[model samples]
Target: MDASPLRDPTIGTGAAAGGPAPGRVVIDARALSLTFDTADGVVHALSDVDLTVREGEFVSFIGPSGCGKTTLLRVIADLERATGGSITVDGVAPAEARTQRLYGYVFQAPALLPWRNVLANVTLPLEIFGMDKASRLEHARRNLDLVNLAGFEKKFPWQLSGGMQQRASIARALSFDPKLLLMDEPFGALDEIVRDKLNEQLLKLWAETAKTVVFVTHSIPEAVFLSTKIVVMSPRPGRIIDVIDCDLPADRTLEIRETAQFLAIAHRVREGLRAGHSYDD
Candidate 1:
């Protein structure tokens, strides 16, 4: 949970995007492209992408193996520099906001500290920022409750199940209460059962907090269920192919995955994924 509590609440109250400002945008990207000059060749990880994420929308990125899903995420997080174009988070440069701890990023793995207890793990970011013990402790308790892990705070990472550990990681991320959350395949290693359970909790958290999330995944059904919008990308000089708005009825439950509209959205995402996979460049 490399996050600072001063940024956002453990859960926010935002109900829509374009809400933080009167007429301004929360996130904006214009003709964004990122190319890496590796010895093998110039890797065009992203190209000519124009995207906007409102203050509290949930967006997902899905595509094939080399489609630049994670790369695009990194660029927005300011972890990577785009070769061209511009990206701004919360109307500020990503680099500055990131340095200021504007949001917390959850990568593919939990990456928790084994030696630390669950509470300590969640408080790691605050510790780095020089927050005192009493303050971090109180903040950690609130986040643990947000993720439904309040009783397990004293347990070490090794003491928890995979699902629980991931939950702890999420609590760690949210303990700082960032308005924007960037996740790169955070559930990629879990079983379907565990993944589904986490999905329910994630939606609940999103509803409670109204935080903006940008998730990267290769799973069509997962993307369809969790996102208000899905951005499809293609590989080989990876570029955005389409940006589809998910018009599914809100208040989605696990059962919603089986509904007609959900499946239809899944079908559309699959078609897009297939198209991205077939492209050589």
Candidate 2:
């Protein structure tokens, strides 16, 4: 897969090594916490969480199941409110950011409308936003092509493969051109082969768009492969355990996974998870 878009001369993580300078902060969260009051009792999903995501960076959140990875992503998207602390998306409140359409969210499932063809599905957000038919169609076509789904426009969601449906979902997310893309395990259901292909496409897409991305995944390899930074969290009552920087080549391929640097980063991620996990739980 041509990774030319992400190619850079630098070989390591820091800007001192002549790497690209850091972009302005796109997401800033300090002492962020979320709790739920259910019929049974109080459930703390997150606590004392702090994180920052900058423009054009691929940040992944990884931990065990029920570790509040999705919850944290949702909080950033304004789908769930933080009970305490502060978070700013693009220097504004998440709710305000959502109102301004500062980010596009992709849930675990493709969540495409089964009845609508791919073109219509991709254009649905634009249609809801009161865009003209011609303009929405143009945006839909451009995004579908961006995701390599150009000719599948006439196919309904049911007619497409699972991977294709997810690609359509990604197209729908990109159609509106949001500044940040928030994905929650969008490829978790796919087999290994399909997942790797989508990961490659996602990296190329990220390189081409330069949009900030915050992804949630349980797979350590997936997190390490695609992220410039990996945030490891504790099992429920999720707290940031470790934040590992990835210094791999910008033009990295799946084969990079076998390299010493990649394995070292993956090892650190594994150690962080082990440190935070409790077998009893």
Candidate 3:
């Protein structure tokens, strides 16, 4: 794995259209730190972390449970405020970006309403945003198809498998067509076989949508397989330990996991994780 991540070509390159380039900076964090003042005393969640996620990139934050992987994602989503330093999404504050509907977030659980069917669940966000019923249904149908849940729209949450329910949750997050997708261990609960299949589908969906994804995960292989850039974080008082660039080709399959290149990247991630633990000792 490369120590420095690869820069997206569209970043500096000029766009033919008068609009901003496709790969402009989407998320920027500088000396970012967050602390939780609780009854148990102060909890340092993040410390002096600097990171940049470009437009249309798949970036995964991986670390042990106590690390701030999900915290970082929450910060980006404006679910939690940073106590120190500065951060921006689309060149604006996270709060402003959030108010502008700049991003959509997916949590660890599917979180679909039991009372609502797939199509209704998917279009719920649009309804809250006051989109017309017809347009909301149209977007719901298209996103359901994107997640391979087209015919299952009428199915209730109880009727679908765990993976299918998660897909519907994904569709809901995408209903408003957000520029960035913030996922916090979305597939962490699924069994290995189902997780792998969903990973494949997710890659295909990302390729088609080109939405900048900031994902949090604990699985090394999952992080390597899904991310163009893998950010490894340290344990408590979390900080970045390594940022490994996944040099593998974009169009990949499960079989690629057996390749030497794949193992090499995984090895680097493991080493980085080990190093973080050692530093904590």
Candidate 4:
């Protein structure tokens, strides 16, 4: 599905606002495929999947359950190996990019240690990287503030609400200052009101940091609201069904979802999902 005609021409490419210039590819994948050797049989998780993520773009992958969205993200993070074709991150192999700390990944869960307080949890990665105590504390505090968790340093994971815990997780991911952020449905478990609030916060965070983001989600509105580009995928042997450019206003609010233009883009995304057999029996 071609969505270029729907793109707003007035929107700038975001280079002037400290965002990465257009045409700089952060992720390049060609004919990428992955298969699992199961005891029952070989399972194809992805096939001939080609994708490109430009610098500073908030790209979201939306698909049905079991469609390899997270698998593809893991491949880019070097957490999973592709069985065929080639892929690169920051113009280098995924492994090399990971070794260089080119990206930070936030999983579905907060994944914070229960025994540690928010400050200690956020500083854990820096601690592992051999950063000094003073420097680690500084980084942790700064990121916590960035995520609006400045006063919760002493609170343990169990002490905070679910949304706050996820914010702490995000702060921990940002502690190392990676240029790219990979998120796998980080707000999937939150209540609708909390999810909406976090979605808004996440967009602001993306803008302030000007970081390239690759997100995985199953929600149409969430994907449309948060993405600069939305990748629609097919089932099991996941393939790119459509890549829709979402040129909505950079500083959009949740209220924008009610507008005609927003609804139009969302309609296209729904059509793409339908075309991909996302609702097949």
TM-score of each: 0.89, 0.93, 0.92, 0.92
RMSD of 1: 4.9
Clashes of each: 5, 0, 0, 0
RMSD each, Å: 4.9, 4.3, 3.7, 4.7
Candidate 4 backbone clash number = 0
Which portions of model 1 show Cα errors greater than 4 Å? 1-24, 279-281
Clashing pairs in 2: none
Residue pairs that clash (backbone atoms under 3 angstroms), model 1: 1-172, 8-177, 12-209, 17-55, 18-55
TM-score of 3: 0.92
Off by over 4 Å in 2: 1-19
* Tens-digit per-residue lDDT, 1-281, candidate 3: 22112234454344443333345678999999999998999998999999998777899999998799999999998999999999999999999999999898999999999999999999999988999999999999999999999999899999999999999999999989998899999999999999999999998888888788999999999999998899999877899999998878888899999999999999999999998987544
Residues 1-281 of candidate 4 have per-residue lDDT tens digits of 11222222344343343323464678999999999999989888899999998777899999998788999999999999999999999899999999998899999999999999999999999998899999999999999999999999999999999999999999999999997899999999999999999999999998777778899999999999999999999886788999999989888899999999899999999999998884647
Off by over 4 Å in 3: 1-22, 279-281
Ten-residue segment with the worst summed lDDT in candidate 4? 1-10
